[model samples]
Target: MTKLAEMQCEACQVGAPQVSDEELANLIKMIPDWAVVVRDGVMQLERVFKFKNFKLAMAFTNALADLAETDFHHPGILTEWGKVTVTWWSHSVKGLHQNDFIMAAKTDELLISGK
Candidate 1:
């Protein structure tokens, strides 16, 4: 299997299946900073990226949006003065998908690449 960051997201349409518990556990290991959480009783993944100022925070958010567009999977992003909290889940399936973890890895790549 491709590394999560090296993979592209597959669409999570209404009938799509969420990732298996085994799969999610393995993938989450690749992005340890991310937390598996329940929101509205649906499982999701979240992580907060910190920055020195609002400008850098917004820059990260924009880069993340661009990445999401490429993958056709967007996350819920909260841009604050010095941090951006990103939440990823499959809205249609209402749970976690491989795409969510893949995008989470890509999000970390954004910070590492400093783009």
Candidate 2:
């Protein structure tokens, strides 16, 4: 199994993969501060990485790009002066998939390490 597949909730294991939209909504609602969102056919988790200037932001963007490429699960990244919006959705599925949440968790891990 892939890394994402290996990441299973102990109690929720042995069931169907991925989550329904209603399940997703309830789960997301519980995590009121995650900034993880689903809308307009996208599953996104946005984080504002603060930096002193635009150069630092660009550098972080490049680093994030490298990480995305290594994972083979890319996100829609919008880099501005001090923030980069990362939206992760499985294009093949035409909706949110398990990979999207896995990637979001991985991205959050990355931000923690960068700090």
Candidate 3:
């Protein structure tokens, strides 16, 4: 089977479920680094963007914002000295929908492109 098939099957095994608060929290703990637990009890996939300085971080943030706007899906972003934390969750579902994973993969692509 293809990778997509595998992922889909795996998701289905979990009932194609939207992650519960407890489950999401456990998953985040299992997958450390560049991820956090959100205040709304959702999964927040974060990445620490190390830029040369604050200026670069701001520029990246702007570009990232544009992408999010175009997708019509937004994430919670926290900008600091040289890092940006991005968190994604489906507010409508009040949990983690498949769209969250798709966005997370796209977000990973964005980060990979930067490298």
TM-score of each: 0.95, 0.65, 0.64
Residue 19 in model 2: shift from native, Å? 2.3
lDDT of 1 at 97: 85
Per-residue lDDT of candidate 3, residues 22-107 (tens digit) = 75565455334446556657545666667778887787788778867766778778888887777776666565665565555555
Over the full model, what C-alpha lDDT does candidate 1 score relative to the true structure? 0.90
The alpha-carbon RMSD values of the candidates against the true structure, listed in the order shown, are: 1.0, 6.1, 5.8
Clashes of 3: 0
Best candidate, lDDT: 1
Q: Using TM-score as the measure, what is the rank order of every candidate, best first?
A: 1, 2, 3
Give per-residue CA lDDT, model 2, range 1-115, as digits (tens): 3444225322223333456867677645533445766688555555565667788778777877887776677888888887777776666555556666666666666655772
Q: Give a tens-digit lDDT track for model 1, residues 40-85.
A: 8999999999999999999999999998888888899999999999
lDDT of 3: 0.61
| lDDT, ranked from best to worst | 1, 2, 3
Worst 10 residues of 1 by lDDT: 6-15
TM-score winner between 1 and 3, please give it. Answer: 1
